[model samples]
Target: MKSALKISGYCLIRKNRVVLDGRVLFETGPMDFSSFAAEAYLHFNTCYPKFHKMDNLSKLGFLASDILIRDKKITESFKGREIAIMLMNSSSSLDTDKTYQQTITDRNNYFPSPAVFVYTLPNVVIGEICIRHKIYGEGNFFITEKFDAILLDHIVNHLFNDGLALCCIAGWTEVNGENYESALFLIEESSGTGSGIANFGPAETESIYQGI
Candidate 1:
């Protein structure tokens, strides 16, 4: 089993804007998809300045990790630390898939853009996180009707017990056309709070998806 993990910090992005920085966590809001994407791009660009403009999921993932590291103070100290991602999305990258389909529909005169294909899967975000942080740990993504606290709590606990990762960046990053909102948390073992993962009963669960 992996050693017990603690949630030292957290960061959140909402409607593509930096609603929550470092220790802040914001509730979801009603926002268009394009606006959210643009906001994500903007906040990421501002936070990562040098590397945020890269037009790739991998770069975005790295930027996200960088934010967490800088905010949570988990830096070179966690160079080889096992980290996992449990990212959830509503559409399963339907937006990118639509673009990809458009490319294929006109194969006679169309060639798939590598950029669109790269982000056709929700887990692409996780891959980006892993690559940027050097996390050689277990990673998974799910398409849920909406966020569910029960499933998240159970899975996160399993990861800790199984030694998959010391901590996890578990949340939803859904972008469809021009509507998007995200509410994520940094879940880890902690004796300081409730019961850590186990204590995430109904109350805590409800807390995660506050604006749902």
Candidate 2:
């Protein structure tokens, strides 16, 4: 039987708040990005201590994925290798890159921390999510001027057709200074479970993204 793609779950985070599948999970008054992220981490009960040490980009991805996968039960049913991740953002870790650059900009006070420097790459956020969820499948990160749901849908469909993954965590995650947003979806082959929304094509994906 041919596999039918479906959207099993989704999460959106923005403006110091998190919403999972149309339900508000966490919300806080005005606060810095770092503080807001920390509050979300604590509210989600994520015991990952390293979350505090990660750069803003990684923290955003980690927190968003943590809520989506855990609340949606993606990891419990799908093996680590069966799941893939494809994330995109406009900033492309420029937030962390600028921070890292500041450290070395002053030669006399130069003190580049490996922890901060390591997250300079946008793909590092994918690595952090994979490590947290033990997902060893294929993953990619793209930098685009804005969210491209059609491009994301095509890439994820290719992964499924090529037998590279059975499920995918795909979406846009962007963080720059006080501005941050993420809209992640869990796409999987329909097994007649009757629990997921059917027809996960480019238009459908774009609609969902736009609705968020």
Candidate 3:
């Protein structure tokens, strides 16, 4: 069996605050979801124009992954298809679903935007991340009552053990109205350089997330 995986990096976003590797990168007062995400993008100096066009769900995933892999040193070492992404959330795009519902609620002014309609599925966030990073690896999005660290750990390990991916981005991202939270971790083989958390499993993941 392969050695236990390690957490190379992680980012957490919640309550108008952003934390990376246990350090606060940005914080703000009450703001809408769009403004909150936009502030984070700007704080990181991210220049991706597509960010503005994405729904709240995609934007949350994109920002969390972008921050976690900003340096690119870790991800660049592997092929595009060698990196996977797994994400879960409780809301499952309900935030966008509500917005989309508003457009069609009035029959006389019914106008459902194709742009908004496309993001109804939660997995679209994964596609956005893949598009930005050019990752062609396996990816999936799940909806659960709450974060399930054990399932995430098992699936991530399965991908690595099966040679489906050399590394993975796994975590939870949920956005509902003005409330949003995300915790993303980059999992890969242990390099034994002491550059990351040496032990990565359900317990460790849950601990890190709770602490965040």
Candidate 4:
């Protein structure tokens, strides 16, 4: 048996509220995705100016990541290359795609700005997190019809078994229009730490994502 895997920490974001380790850290009334995201940015004191420039999808993912990875200082415990990130979503940046399309639908009003153009891809959120935390390990983003906790379980295990990663951040993040949901978990081996919050496996992971 390759030592136990543990779910050290996790964060969930939904309906303009952010939850960390089962506690609601921030919650707000009805608001647009941009307004909620900006409010979250300020509330958390992220201090990253680039956050304001990111599209809705990136902002959502970045916020969840910052709460789990940066705020918790998970990356500080492992080497950059020893950490990995795996994220899955349903919309796959469609929210930003729609916005991009709006800027070019009119022949005369079409505008191509790199600022908005760069966030067209879903993995950009992964890029932003990696850049912020200096995580150089393997990172992969997948698009599924819905959250597939089993698939994520297998991938995370494979990375650890093959020595591709010592610690990992994996979960589901999806943003469509004003709706968004994310549940990111920080997984680590059980040698040094006491069992963590719980073991990292399909059942545990799926349960958390399901409940979230």
For candidate 4, report its TM-score: 0.95
- 99-161 in candidate 1: lDDT tens per residue? 788988875878878877877877877766665557766778888888776777678778888
Q: Model 4: per-residue lDDT, tens digit, 109-162?
A: 878767877888999999998998899999999999998978988899899999
Question: Whose lDDT is higher: candidate 1's or candidate 4's?
Answer: 4
Q: What's the true lDDT of residue 15 in model 3?
A: 86
Candidate 1, which segments miss by more than 4 Å at Cα?
1-8, 21-65, 77-81, 191-202
Q: lDDT of each structure?
A: 0.59, 0.87, 0.88, 0.87
Q: How does residue 110 of candidate 1 score in lDDT?
A: 84
lDDT (Cα, tens digit) per residue for candidate 2, span 63-87: 8898888877777888999999999
Candidate 3 error regions (>4 Å): 192-194
* Candidates sorted on TM-score, descending: 4, 3, 2, 1
Model 3: lowest-lDDT 10 consecutive positions: 191-200
> Model 2 reaches what TM-score against the true structure?
0.95
TM-score of every candidate relative to the true structure: 0.72, 0.95, 0.95, 0.95
Task: State model 2's lDDT.
Answer: 0.87
| Clashing pairs counted in every model | 7, 0, 0, 0
Query: Candidate 4: which stretches are off by over 4 Å?
Result: none
